[model samples]
Target: MDQMFQIGDSILTVSLPVELDHPNSQAISQQIDEILQEQYIRGIVFDFGNTTFMDSSGIGMIMGRYKALGMRQDSIRAIRVNRRIYKILNLSGIYKVMKICRQVEE
Candidate 1:
């Protein structure tokens, strides 16, 4: 569970873990929800560079944050999504809600 947050401007860039499954997914959602509450976050950028696998819980987590952010629809994004995970997001219609970038963070 390697996660790090890089705050940029009003974007809360989050580096996700390799396996974003249950338990941790719920924890991550809770943590992000907490931040959105006490802070003035305007957007979120999820970095999926290291993520290899994920379950439906990942989508739930993202959706939870999107709703919690008051539907700041255009501010949510996902970065460095590999083919496998990209398929997951694509099939889940996540791209319609957030931007997908193949660029990895160096």
Candidate 2:
């Protein structure tokens, strides 16, 4: 499946695609920007259950949202991240800015 976005309780949950490369990352970033402009989002949750590959563009996209959200603590989250993606997130220093979870939080 492609990327999907869901919003609830002021949080935006982004269900990422299997491959988060330059092409899709740019599109996803634009879509998320539109959503941000239209809604009163308090946080963002990136769901990586179906994602297996991610490039630097993906990391940049997430960071863009972090900045868009005013860099609030716990305002960004990564859930269902696999080992490979976890390593990427960790090495990209995303762990320092966002919450990384093995499972979705309620």
Candidate 3:
């Protein structure tokens, strides 16, 4: 699965692929970091509409980004997560740490 990222004026949206496993972790992390460094980012939004699988590494990826944004009083959000993924987020306590929305509005 290919990971794609898009940056808007107020947010960075990472369009994660079908599986967010180890193989794509480094690439996603590096791309996110680069985007963060290259922009005066206000927030990050993870679009999970197409994601079919995510393991603990995926949890770590989101947590890492959450911690990064916390330092600057910013935040990261997750959107369009299906029931299975929502359970993962809930079980990992990520739903408490980040906002999960039904959609992204401009």
Candidate 4:
């Protein structure tokens, strides 16, 4: 997984890997947590541009982040989601927790 976190303005952008499974998801989850603790994040954008596969662990990762940010009322958005992954996210009911953006703000 490409593990890169980009921050601009009030948003933090995280580009996920092509396959968001257990190992990578764990790393990502930890990284995101570290970033949240270190930065003043107003919003989070999870970019699934290169992601082609995701599993239950990925769902857990997303949900965990969503709930953590929710406590602070920090907004979260999913971006660049293709149809297949979008279906997974939809089935997991993540849209109810976070906004799904058509285009992510830079």
Best by TM-score: 2
For residues 1-106, write the lDDT of model 4, one tens digit per residue: 2347998896889999999999999999999888889888778889998999999999999888877776444388789888888899899998887777655553
Give the TM-scores of the predictions, in the order they appear: 0.90, 0.94, 0.87, 0.87
Best by lDDT: 2
Worst 10 residues of 2 by lDDT: 1-10
Error of 4 at 89 (Å): 0.6
Error of 2 at 56 (Å): 0.5
Q: Candidate 4's C-alpha lDDT?
A: 0.84
lDDT of 2 by residue, 9-30 (tens): 9989999999999998999999
**lDDT of all predictions:** 0.85, 0.93, 0.81, 0.84
Query: Candidate 3: misplaced stretches above 4 Å?
Result: 1-3, 71-74, 103-106
Model 2 TM-score, 2 decimals: 0.94
lDDT of 2: 0.93
C-alpha displacement of 46 in model 2, angstroms? Answer: 0.2
Between 2 and 4, whose TM-score is larger?
2
State candidate 3's TM-score: 0.87
Q: Write the per-residue lDDT of candidate 1 for residues 55-81, one digit (tens) a residue.
A: 999998998888888876687889888
Model 1 gets an lDDT of 0.85
Estimate the lDDT of model 3.
0.81
